[model samples]
Target: MIGPRERVPQAGRRGTRMAEHTGPGRSAVVIGGGLAGMLAVTALRGHFDVVTVVERDRYPADRTFRKGVPQARHLHILLSGGQRALERLLPGTVAALTEAGARRLYLPRDLLTRTPTGWQRRFDERRHPTLSVTRPVLDAVVRERALGAAAGPATRVEVLEATEAVGLTGDARRVTGVTVRARNGDRGAASRVLPADLVVDASGRGSRTPQWYAELGREAPQEVTVDSGLAYATRMYRPTARGEAPDAGVNVPGWPECPRGAAYVPVEDGNWLLTLSGVRGHHPPTDEAEFTAFSATIGDPYVHELLARAEPVSPVHGFRDTCNRRRHYERPGGVPDGFLVLGDANCTFNPVYGQGMSVAALGAVALRDTLDAAGGPGPGVLARAQRAVGRAAEPAWIAAVGADRPYVRGGGAKAGLGERLTTWYLDRLTARAAVDRVVGAAFRDVFCLTAPPSRLMAPRVVLRTVLLPRRPGLPRPPTAVEPA
Candidate 1:
């Protein structure tokens, strides 16, 4: 990794020179050194001779929080789909995470979820497995793996830390590189252009690609948003007694009728994260006393009961940027050639759904696959790759928007006949999923991104979800893994 003082060897305009000349003249630059940017670097291996990552904040030396990622203090999980994608990009990443104190929680089996109906059954189908870990740990491990993978003999990956990308270097027709400057507390540093064949905007939710495009006399990509006005507060805790810790995590999600939710899940270092959430009028409080008291008001009392036996280990942290926003970069003439957008920059889901990181990894995998299919960076390749990244985020986007549409202020627009009917069926399906194993498996498959939404419409799943009697879930959280 290159420090802020180090300069990437550059030559004159249009066609520039790489730091270490080898292979071809191809080079790529990724803006943002977060999880998405690191994975983007891994994907560019072999495809680009030299790949540079520009990051505004210097990464911490250890597994600790940094200003670059404000949500690092919150609970984060890598879903089954994301694990597979990360492993594909950099082999054994999941195992590396687990070895570094990340906990593996099987879906529905190791997680106790309370739907609108009641507490869901603990089904040991073992189809989907998720990793529960602090965001810092996750970022550290993935960053190490991705950087390590990028250090092959074929491709050279350079990380420019404490560097900021100011704008694009090319016209609206095609991006040639990025104009960046050192962010090392120097206000007078002159901006310089780093020429590249491709530029990936992985700057995340704070991306200014739209404004950059406008500066180039091009229209910004169309955007869509679905905000439920959800806000959440999180704090770390450790059980007062070793034996007092629950065997599994608890999640009591909000519904339209209640609109209050809570999740208490175990993380590394014998710590657990308890996050309390609510929409608009019922936002969770950040006060110490009120935070604990609010846990009791959620749909289920199991989390509140667990909190009573746990001692607080960290101050409460609240996050309110829960809106689901998508930039339509895949549409025709939306983005110029040689430029691509992925991760949160393209589609950002409400943090409550826990889909952001997974979607980012999936998008990187799509980028790698698209580049492989196209052979290398060329005319129309970046445009096609951007569309592929968009496709990767579709499942999570649909699920989040559908879930939040009901909570939008003023009820938004009236649903069409098909949407209304689909919503009706989904409500019943969600209720049925809590108790029925078949329905639960189907529902989880889509929720985990391991299967398409059409999985819920399978004949067997549809019959069970439609014809079966609406049975309530277990009245209490099951202490055992499987039903007796």
Candidate 2:
């Protein structure tokens, strides 16, 4: 918990080392300059003397999309758990984001959310308040803070834009640095190795750590991917008056019968981001006419009605290939010392769950605790840190994979008894939650990641779900919130 204005450590160049890092002289190299990379920089404040963040794309001014991140145009909102974790790392970050036009919202109350079971009932007050903003805007604000530009003294982190990590520099036992290339096609400039005490492959979901490890004579980490084949079609629109549904966000989650989903999120600048999504063979279309029609395939058409009135600002954008990918770095022979991976590099969730960014923030916070426990960054601590990061991500992973497991199996691989029982209980919980305020609030806590999924399985919750008769599904979207 260093002050905002503290003299941040400035690490100097330290080359290759076979032995583990001892006392001080702490330094680190973070590959990838996205939200995870920035937060990692912030977390390394007290522990490292020098930290370098190497990004492949040159960042633009403000919250504009960078070249490397194709999903920046998609709708992104920070879950409550992530927001709190971020604020803990960099104070005033939440205020900075809100000042930049990101709105904080209540979970089921502020949004018209139709879950797998039914519509979520709104309440006058709730604890889970999530932050809404475009991916680019969120990245920019966090980058500014992590780079020492947001009210903090000159930080230890140095940004090397237009740079990419090509390979690990050390041997199989331990990693000491990384080989990098400037994205600029300078044939004359040869590839160079940047030395460091530690290296982080936060290079994202497409990270080549497996290949790099293979080249270093180490076994590749076990990779688990559950591809539900979910596709996203997003289009930006001018804000339209709520009229009947006075909600800040609208979500219709897809279920088996209605295999389609849709969401409308209020981003900065009075704009709206509406996305239509589906799984496997039932992907949403990008055509204007078909996109609107796809909305009907979902549970409700309220989102379509609202979009019909709003003016289109951006063309329809489609993103496919969203799969839940989890690399088992915690397994033996999975990770090397003095090197670790976080964020999408370690685990990539199905974006439809909206847990990626939140998990990333949580992983960063967990990294801080791991570093403190290890008493500084070094070879001895790298594996433990990776395990801790994986632990922090476990809850989100379970929620996402559990929900998506049924979809991908396509009537073949049936969900185990545990999953079946869990789903049945949750579905009942959702039905009762629509009419019950306390139940709704508790559900919102798990949805927003403010609490663990185990809360839904509590004796009280289970008993209520089992004893109470199911409430009638809302005849329509819960457009108007009744004052409680």
Candidate 3:
């Protein structure tokens, strides 16, 4: 229960007295203790005296399942772009994950991917690196490092587990803090407010920032949702040894022609994380028999063949909330001072693309950069930070939304002439990449987020795309034994 002294009046409405923190603050409160929340706290530590992360679930002592992050059961790969951002933010995060048994894969070279167009030919020396680890291992290592950094001099970082934020405590003009309640729901569960000079909502896809805004008497940020109706079912397996093992990683793309896709990724402990997926009416089933059959429906059958006899470490896990949901938090005057949103809360992409955590890391970098340029945390700084974060996520959003629009239901914005032309061009480029190293290198850069989408539009790439005849694709997955 909150003491009477702790309760403060909301900032009220626009015409009323506002509670704007015109300068840097002593404390900040971050809602959600997931990756985004922890990184948010890290971003604020240099600018604030104290920071606190509130999470609804108790922190697991080991890398095991927790109620909060149900989607951890699926496959996740850290793109090189995300790796660079996180390494910059937390320094040596990439090495740490590698040391934890994560597979450090070089793109295309180590991957036996089957793109929608065809099999992607491997190169000998591409440097686009990706990390594959179980979600629990990734999250635990990040948590440990962030908490350790907080314990250092100059700032205080704390965590309050089993606490759920119920509402915002301020008005439309400016946000002051968050109102919260214990998750245990004990009989004496009186609510309390966590005061702050700034508040960040990094609560993932289930975020309540909109409701909190409405409670503050402000208009909710406009939203855009493009759901492809994709459902994913993943199972963990202690893969077979040596010559019989599947490729390091594989992805069968999903499009209208074949709405089913699957991926086999190597994760911690030499176990393989395989996910079977189907879109719209073809959602994958969780039953073991049905799951195996669904894998066969994908463009390729190698994933199915690999999993048909694997020993299971866990039952099939399903996640269905795959949508490109972006809240327009950067709209002029639409966002309140001292309030900002990032991570999946601000924009959630179709998880099939594995962009959520990576985008979150990029958003934290954007937040840190914006705050540093603004000199510190204050009223206008959060607004600017929100806009910058949105920009940071824009590229990934464009890639996911554009790629997914064709598979989504309902009336979405029709593809413009430019979009249709670009799609046609990319189809050829992907085909050309099957045998051309130059095209493959450029494609890998953009796909891995190391380069912008505009990289594909460069004059040299454009000339090659238009002039070079695409070589016929390999007849099958490029997993044949490499020459000695």
Candidate 4:
């Protein structure tokens, strides 16, 4: 039997090509042209006759930081799951990233992380590997691939720059379009309305989707926020001949005691993207002197050493808007029929976990499946898509909240006795992960987004955790040694 799919509307802009509209033939309007919006377009490409991406900022071709995405200046890595999804949507996308200087580095082996447990030991290559590069470069590549996939002569993909989506155009039962306002030349000016079969809000953390839905007489989605007031400071450095290794990249994990994190991701053109982050009550310094000193406190000296040697290529860019916020769009009676939310608009994660981009990519994959199930962008499409996307987002939410709660100052309700027991047992599992290959692989599966967190408590994995030694097994932080 054919899986559930959206039924196409009989009268719509892209309705003439009914055969091509196996999912939805009606027009699709996507607000925001970031990575999530682009990938969402790819997911709905064949299903829609006309796909319009509306953006507040004009997109540029070159790999440089721009407005709308202030977080673009920092070091970003695409988890293995996201890499595979992009490849599935647009073939050779990962290769393109590598060609553009993003390293497809293996985890554990290619990574050097100082965890709360201990320094993670070097291990053999696993099933999944992460892609490391500048956020702008990664976005440029994905944007190019997505535009190529969605744009065509007949089934065209249109992008409206300098346009703002202020309100929904449809009623409470079904959304028909949007009320948009383009930026004025200097001051006050009237905006225009754009109609469509479907409207997707990928407008980042600042999205007004909750208010928009309420104004449409729809119920508001339940909000869950875990904010540690995290702050990130990043600067680019020119990579050196000795440190530019194709095999490994430097990483430093955050701890509960320290609540600060750092990373040195190898990017293209012999460059390294350096980032330092601190949680609530322990903010990282943005100035050159303080930035270097902040790196010294992260329980390691490698990042500090590198910062002292590499030439600074960019000014220190700082961001404190990082928070873990989610809208419960999946719950019953939560979403409307004609509108759906994706990416940071739907949920925002702490950037230190590096889960936002990957989760957004996963949401796009779910978008493809949802469109296929619905048969097109039908009136019932919004609610169904919300549930599907929510399911796809579960893994990342669990991993991020679970690991982050311990570090954040009162980020989560105190762990119950059961939770404390579970935490203690899992600590042993993670301790084993520092040395045991099998345990490391199992843990890495969840940590790398290749598997679910449930795997950590599986029967065999739990038994391993129970059998492992009580004492932590990894080495202490590496210290400077005398020259030969």
Task: Say which candidate scores most in TM-score.
Answer: 1
Rank list by lDDT: 1, 3, 2, 4
Alpha-carbon lDDT of model 1:
0.85
lDDT of all predictions, in order shown? 0.85, 0.77, 0.78, 0.75
User: What is the TM-score of each predicted model, taking all chains together?
Assistant: 0.94, 0.90, 0.91, 0.89
Tell me which residue pairs clash in candidate 3: none
Off by over 4 Å in 2: 1-23, 149-155, 187-189, 240-246, 410-417
Candidate 3 per-residue C-alpha lDDT over 295-405 given as tens digits, one digit per residue, 9 for 90 to 100:
888988878787755777888888898888999897787578778898999999888887888889999999999888887875578888988899888878877777776
TM-score-superior candidate, 2 or 3: 3
TM-score (C-alpha) between model 3 and the true structure: 0.91
Query: Over the stretch 1-484, how does candidate 1's per-residue lDDT look in tens digits?
Result: 2212112211111111223545676889999989999899888888888888888887775578989888787878788988888888989989988988888999898889998888898988788889999998888778777776676766877778788999997898988899999887889999999998889999989999999999888898998877899998999999999699999999998999889999889998899999899998899999999998999888888899898899999999999988988999988887888888988999999888889999999999999998899988767887888888999999888777777777877544444565556667778998999888888988888888889889988999999988989988889998777741
Tens-place lDDT digits, model 2, residues 1-484: 1223222221222211123333366678999988888888877766766677778887764457776888887888888888888988888899989988897777767877776555766666657778888888888778766665422332355667778888998899888898988877676657788898888888887899999998989888888787778899999988556563245688887888777889898888888888899987789999988887887777787787887678788889899968988999976667777888889999999998889998888888988888888877655676787888898888888777777765776632456787677666766787787777767767767867779888887777777778988777565777676664
Count clashes in each candidate, considering only residues at least 3 apart in sequence or on different chains. Answer: 0, 2, 0, 13
* Candidate with the larger TM-score of 1 and 3: 1
lDDT of 4 at 203: 89
Give the better candidate number (3 or 4) by lDDT.
3
Q: What is the lDDT of residue 468 in candidate 2?
A: 80
Better of 2 and 4 by lDDT: 2
**lDDT (0-100) at residue 280 of candidate 1?**
89
